[model samples]
Target: MIRLFKVKEKQREIAENANGRAPVKKQSAGELRLHKDISELNLPKTTTIAFPNGKDDLMNFEVTIRPDEGYYRGGMFVFTFQVSPVYPHEAPKVKCKTKVYHPNIDLEGSVCLNILREDWKPVLNINTIVYGLHHLFTEPNYEDPLNHEAAAVLRDNPKMFESNVRRAMSGGYVGQTHFTRCTC
Candidate 1:
């Protein structure tokens, strides 16, 4: 019975090739869901998504955010997203490609968003994550910080924090650490 099924499958492939049509490639459930998410995406004006590996490879992509307000105003930040095969069942792995001097983002590019970690739920979609990242720039949370120094500055002295953000964004040094220019 198994051999009969294999022969039938081979015949189908041959028939497809004969008709100048390629055999259909089966997609995983995660891919299907990701496609749906991408198709339904309604990104903010300051946010843009790009597929570095091309549109055919939607599993990995990048999102760039240019905040028009807040301390990060006129600065451009890029983040990379790597979606797992399990998709909604597991949250996508996100890392900042741009080094930013913000409380919620570490020097190593790890983001400190609740939804990306403990608060993540299967019900959440890519849009939610994108908005969350955008909100981080507009309202950086000092309480839940990935960079303690930046957080302390933000909490202890708002003015100094703003200064540090400006310096870092302009490719200057914030203490011993230097950041590249991300201003747009």
Candidate 2:
């Protein structure tokens, strides 16, 4: 019975096609909300978003964050965001693509940002997530750290912590762990 409506809709589409126009694809409720959220995004100067799949495909994209001040200053950090079709109700999946030595960011490129996890609320948007990520580098918390060794150093020895950070950022080893060339 619904196929009858589809046939009629198809006829309408065919008629519309005569005007040199293709039938408009219907967007899902999630797509509509995501569009609204994106349009309202007010990103900071240090952050920018890019769609590697192009503008037409907004569901998968990357964000770059360059901290202006902190131990990670001068570093270019990239993150990938995958928004599900059931967005707004479900938070986007976010992961860091840039590898860095940090208490909050894991080796496998998983980030420990609170907004992406337990702290997330439907009211939160992309802008809020970006800001929260930026805060991670500027003020790394030792209390709830993913890298316990780094956190312990930060908590126990402040001066040694600073020195190790400089060493690691310069593409050297803090102890036995060798870091790659860090531009930060």
Task: Give the best candidate by lDDT.
Answer: 1
* TM-score of candidate 1 against the unseen true structure: 0.93
**What lDDT would candidate 2 get against the real structure?**
0.83
How high is each candidate's TM-score?
Answer: 0.93, 0.85
Cα-based lDDT at residue 102, candidate 2: 81
lDDT of 2 at 176: 84
Which lDDT tens digits does candidate 2 get at residues 29-125? Answer: 8788778878888888888989899877788899988888887787788999999888877888988887667888776778888888888888888
lDDT of 1 by residue, 1-184 (tens): 9999999999978987897877777888888999999999999999999999998899999999999999999999999999998988999999999999999999999999999889999889899999999999999999999999999999999999999999999999999999999999
State the C-alpha lDDT per candidate. 0.95, 0.83
How does candidate 2 fare on TM-score?
0.85
